[model samples]
Target chain A: MPKLWNETIEEHRRAVRDTVLETTAELVAEQGLRGVTMSRIAERSGIGRATLYKYFPDVESIMAAWHERQIAGHLDELADLRGRSDTPGARLAAVLERYAFIQQQRHGHGAELSALLHRGGHAAHAEQHLRHFVRGLLAEGVQAGEVRDDVTPDELTGYCLHALAGAGELPSKAAVRRLVAVTLTGLRPQG
Target chain B: MPKLWNETIEEHRRAVRDTVLETTAELVAEQGLRGVTMSRIAERSGIGRATLYKYFPDVESIMAAWHERQIAGHLDELADLRGRSDTPGARLAAVLERYAFIQQQRHGHGAELSALLHRGGHAAHAEQHLRHFVRGLLAEGVQAGEVRDDVTPDELTGYCLHALAGAGELPSKAAVRRLVAVTLTGLRPQG
Candidate 1:
């Protein structure tokens, strides 16, 4: 095949895969994970069942792919926020606020879905990446004398993440912000 | 009936019920929740199926009763810890440490059992009581100027509970203690 033809085919395949993932996510969100199936995803995506199978063997794989994509996007957004901020303290604050809001959004998805998606290898890898990302920010803040150095950066990272996890249960965005503030306060130097 | 005779019968009933709940918990722990049935529980408790049914209609009710007892015991333990310490700061620390260790102990119970037991009216009521208890300790800490007063006691209560929740995933008792320490640090007055 010609080079242009090969590139076009690859692009088309990528587009189809994206469509299937998006359709499966919508079905799961509307009707829940138990209600989704391969055929339903295929039909919703306007693709043949055979074509959907070529991209993903079943609904579970499609959902996993969708979750992976979502996690990556969130990490990228946090990284972007970090880059845009002027100081280490400001950067950490922005990233933590965004993370809390993300958690709050996830609270609406129901426990079953959250439980299913948060298990297994992919979620673990994402969590490790997140810890590393936050730990770096904390180290930066500590070097600048903003964050407390009494505790290890690693421990502080764990503290911040666990503390902010409560944001998922908070009733409003303002509550989420307050949670972030309290969490940030924990990192400040003691009197 | 005579009062002595009535008291003896009530005591017997309570003993039988306790045996049934303990047996069910052991069975569930060894074989997972799905493998447990009323028949197995009755056999393990050395009681007839009819007798068991008179006390608890099914396995779920027995489990709920067991969970309620456990929550009540934990709350009582925390209150006792609070009363033993001399200073407001020491009292808060002791209660928080005990609460974190309690959470860590629950980490061994498996997610299915935890989820099933944490829902519905009884769990909600227990949670409310826990919040009130912790909030009172925090208020005392604030009055003594040991805790930050910038945030409301209610907010600090939520923050402490949520932060210590991460103790459930810690690898050791030491880690649980460290998590509790970080959580307590978060409540200290700002520099």
Candidate 2:
């Protein structure tokens, strides 16, 4: 192939990947990850099947790429929570609000990211991100003595998020804010 | 059909249902739920294609019935924390333990339920049952003054279970226990 033709192909491939990611997110959000088929995605994106497969080996890879994009976006939103305040309580509350806001997104992005992990095999990157997030939160709490020193940061943050995420009862913003409030007060060391 | 023959057929249906449940579960555990197919399930269970359909109209019905059985079993397990106790604190702790045990089983049962919820599409009943379970737990907690009376029982129990269910870290019994302990303590009413 000519050098110019090869360059065109690379640009086209990159475009296809972006389309696949966008289409996959929409389809998966609307129909869940199981509903996303390569043919369906290619058809929806107006791309050929061969081209789509050239970008993704299978549905799981498509979902995996989608997952990474999601994490990147969510982490960016969460970035503000980092260094929001010097104190543990201020940082904790800020992060909790961020977590709650992410959960409250309307397009079911949080739910789908979870379903993808549940549906597809566990991704090491996702797990590591969670561990990092939790470990960071608990480390701060422990150092400041705001949280129990006996417990690992992961254990504290892990279950706290576990509680927050699993809470289907907190259907609205008001409910979650209260949950975050309760969690913060409870986590403070007893006098 | 003769009455005697009808009785025999009914008995056989129960056996077929049990066989289908076991076969599907084994398939899920071995290859994950996505690997389960009608043809494979029947072949593994030594049942004919026609017979499998006769029992379950489609894969969803079979999965729904299996989930219904699991929900029934879980309800039976959680039936005691009601007015059976006067203090919400003790009762709430009991509810937490019950929930934690359920979390421990989630890797096994959770996978199947997750697959059904993710792929099966019979969401209404499953969600209703979840809401019902949490509402009942929170009502008991609130009435006993073990939980804050400000928030509705529905929200409290809903979030608590939601948190517990999401605690998939390590998927170990000890890990679930520790996570649940931290969460339940956080859920305790303020002094």
Candidate 3:
């Protein structure tokens, strides 16, 4: 095939793959994980059944890919926040607050949906990346004298993640903010 | 009926009910929740199916009752700890440590069992009771000048629960103690 023709085919394939993943997520959101099927996804995505199969083997695979994409997007956003901020404490606070907000929004997905999304390799990788991100920020904060030097960064990272996990159960954005503030207090230097 | 006969019947009924609950939990531990059935429970408890029906409507009801009993037992234990002679901070530390241990022990139950056990009215009631217990302790700590007065007792209670929740995932008892200490530091007055 000509170079232009090859590039066009690849771009078309990528667009179709993205559409299928998005359509699967929308269907799941509307009807739940159990209600989704390949035929339904293909019909909703405006793709042929054969073409859909070329992209994903089944609904589970499609959901897994969509979840992976979501985690990647979140990591990219966090990295963007890290790059924009100068002070370690400010960067840590920004990341923590954003993370708490993400957790709060996650509540709207419902427990069944969350259970479906929070399993397997992608979830584990996302967790490891999150811990590493927070640990690096804590190490910088300790050196800056803003966060406590007494505890190891790894321990502090665990404390932050565990405490912030409660944000998902909180009632409002304001409550999440208050939770983050309280968490930050625990990391402050002792007299 | 004669008084002696009636008392003996009542005693037998209590014994049978306790046996049924214990058998159900044991079966769930050995095989997952779906593996349990009325016949299995009756067989394991050494009771006939008809007699088992008199105690619980179904497996769901039996599990709910078992969870309720567990919560009540936990509350009684916590109340006992609260009654011991100590400063407010000391009482809080003892309670937090015990709670952390309980969370750690809960790990033996596994996530699927946890999901089954954490639903319904009993879990909500236990949560409310726990919050009230912690909030009361925080109020006492603030009055004693051991806990910070800047944040409301309710907020501190939330912070304590959130931070200490990490205990469930900690690798050892020492790590749980360290996490609790970090949480307490947040509740201390700023220098």
In the range A37-67, model 3's lDDT, one tens digit per residue, is 9999999999899989988898988888898
Best-matching candidate per DockQ:
3
Task: Give lDDT for model 1.
Answer: 0.89
Residue-level lDDT tens digits of model 1 in B100-164:
89988898899889888987589999999999999999999999999999888988888999888
Error of 2 at B124 (Å): 3.6
Tell me how much of the true interface, by contacts, candidate 2 captures.
0.64
Lowest lDDT block of 10, candidate 2 chain A? A162-171
For model 3 the local lDDT of residue A116 reads: 73
Which residue runs of candidate 1 sit more than 4 Å off their true CA positions? A1-3, A31-40, B1-3, B34-40, B86-88
Give candidate 2 regions above 4 Å deviation.
A1-70, A106-127, A166-172, B1-9, B31-50, B57-61, B80-86, B109-113, B121-123
Against the hidden reference, what TM-scores do the models get?
Answer: 0.87, 0.71, 0.86
Worst 10 residues of 2 chain B by lDDT: B115-124
For residues B54-93, write the lDDT of model 3, one tens digit per residue.
8999998888888888888887887799889489998988
DockQ of prediction 3: 0.65
Give residue B171's lDDT in candidate 1 (0 to 100): 81
Best by lDDT: 1
